[model samples]
Target: MLIPAVAARLDPGWASRVAAARRKLWLALFHPRTVLEAFRGETPGFRPHRPFWGMRGGVSAVFVERLLTLLTALPSVRINPVGRLRHMASGPRGTVLLDFAAPPGGAPQRLSLPAATCALGLGAEELFRAAGVDYAPQRLSVAFGWAEVAEADLRHCPFSLLLAAPGAPALRVSAGPVAEGGRRVMALEFGHVPEGLPHPGAAEARRALEETGLLREGAPMRLLGVTSLPCLQVPSFDNRRAFQAALAAFHARGPEGWAGQLLCGAGRLGFDSMNEQILTGLRIGEP
Candidate 1:
């Protein structure tokens, strides 16, 4: 029998928020359980909190970087690291034609290949719009850093202690220790940092850590590095409509035409979901 459970949970106006929450919960819970069931041959069952949230804050650049490295290693994959896509259109024999803007002091290039063979790495609202599709996406900026910490202390640190004061620039600190370059490190991630505010340096980070007792007062610690992701999309009604239009356009082209839409570019908040998206594409894109 057909069940309307999903429809029942969604209400007008608030549908997007509810839907987003559902997705967040599913990704937080079911995804990990599925992974455990697959790799360990056991189910993790219900969890009080998303295990990775405390430790990693749901961000893992290393996973995506590794996946990209593997793809680049594949001889069949053609990567254009510097070239910019100028135009795209459907061509004969189920192929898609792509035009690349000439790099400085370089000639423009064009390539045609099976539509299913190509995948866009990032959102392409302008490209879709050029092709007569209405698409818009909103994005925000965020930053993260790694700080060397004693693994024992990180393990004992509670999630509540990692949170910032109400008006603090630091969004939340990750108590979980992650390995980087053979060194164990804790992550301090920030969201909505003031535009002109300088990044917290080693001293500032040390103070923050000391305040939480994760780092001993006057203890020597190193700030591994800091980086920012500028184009994290913010979900909204307009963006959803635009994304659907773009999807419909590809669907009209062919069954596999939509396969190129990468999960990392699906307007999700965090880039960590890229790994999940890759897994999903692999699972469903094939027969």
Candidate 2:
């Protein structure tokens, strides 16, 4: 049977240091509640919060949510939705040890399971680095929020569009219309500016949206939000080589070491690849 609680314990000081090295606060800050909400919406038992109702354009979330719901219903599965992972290591008896901080003020906790039964969902680049793997981000994401357009008014606009210009930033704008009585706004995401380059402010986004025919030329685009994710990862030869080397080294320690445990962002370059990863994780008892 799936147990909500794992039968292991962890040390508070060690967990604290791991969390500090991982900079959990920075992770929490960079990924605002909106992004986390969309991520959580991909999990089983995801009920669209009132504010998130009518949200569209995140096709990956839709696909994964349905798939996970069906899988989680199988017997012997447990879901522990509370806690922040701090560290992972090998334990005695061919098991792996997962240390984390559970709710109520980051109390230390641990879970021990057979090595073959554990799957690391540490897809974020920062998380892998925290786990002692050396690699760098191949791409980053910058988001901009513009003036709200009523869904009814934008019925003709496509759910998403890509815009690029000769001397401007390329962007992918997606519509995320909240339910009635809530603020509805469209979001624009683009690649990060290179080092030493000044931010291409909201005006750039407005111009791109206009050129893409999603915004009127003279529309008042009152910027509502600006978010940056500097650690986004994508597949590249160097990244794959480094990742594979790290996995091999981790495995060399022991047959059941953390070799292939990392669920990195290598194959999740797009929505279709992400869906494939989700399916693979479920089939292999990783979910």
Candidate 3:
């Protein structure tokens, strides 16, 4: 759903407040290190006895960071924000729409809730109560299989081929064409499951990767995605790497067939970049 449409249904002033809350939550989840100091101990000037309100005031930074890491590590968990008050979170378990509201004349006593309440099986009320947030609940409609959706979307879109390897923690090598400064350039993204069977060491993995022709020689790679298990983004790749060929190569070497399945889809450039901007702006300690 579009954010503006959702915000239009809320009270005039509430929209901005909700947007602020969404921003704060995004920052805590994506940029945990920036706010680590806040969670080292009881934050100064935070009076729990007083009617402290909003997520920044109500929840400890440590709790937020831990929750973010836990939820993102799950096999299934998607957070899509439609507006300040309306958020869509879904997983293999179920889906939820969080509709937030502010108590009149004072800040909320709680600002965030555990992912388990909404993502696992707990009810919405329980989630709000735990986070000390006051909110009205509404039914949420859900569609399953986010990976399937991605596959479908990329089926007809132009893209480059990357390799997928199956192991305890599956690995996906993302390579594709991206539009940059009026020209098109190749980009590579590397991701792996956060939890699972032990895998190769970084040096071994890198050595193996260099042999496969997926990445260019000495190409600079930057980390992205959730901080706890950031994905690598490489700006270029060797010409020999092809999607189908890589898939075959990965499959030939293993009985597990590259960690159960292969991922084929068009990569979206700048999506992560935009999200980072939002996270940086909403960092904790900002008034």
How far off is residue 120 in model 1, in Å? 5.2
RMSD of 2: 15.5
lDDT of candidate 2 at residue 241, scale 0 to 100: 62
For model 3, how does the per-residue alpha-carbon lDDT over 53-97 read when each residue is reduced to its tens digit? 333322245456776789788878764322123332322333222
Q: How displaced is residue 188 in candidate 2, in Å? A: 0.9
TM-score attained by model 3? 0.21
In order of appearance, the predictions have TM-scores of: 0.56, 0.61, 0.21
Model 2 clashing residue pairs (backbone): 2-76
**Best-fitting candidate, scored by lDDT:** 1
lDDT of each: 0.54, 0.51, 0.30
TM-score result, candidate 2: 0.61
Greater-TM-score candidate between 1 and 3:
1
For candidate 1, lDDT tens digit of each residue in 135-233?
Answer: 565544566777887554442455434342443435456654345543356677654334576766676567667766666677557888877665445
**Residues 1-287 of candidate 2: C-alpha lDDT, one tens digit per residue:** 00101000111122223222222111212234444565477533334634323324444576557766976897877766536656667789888777776776556778877786456665544344435555453444434445565454343466665443334444557766464754457776554545565655677667666767666666655567665655443334454466666655445543354434545343232212454565766766633
Model 2 C-alpha lDDT versus the unseen true structure: 0.51
Best by TM-score: 2
Q: Score residue 142 of candidate 2 by CA lDDT.
A: 39
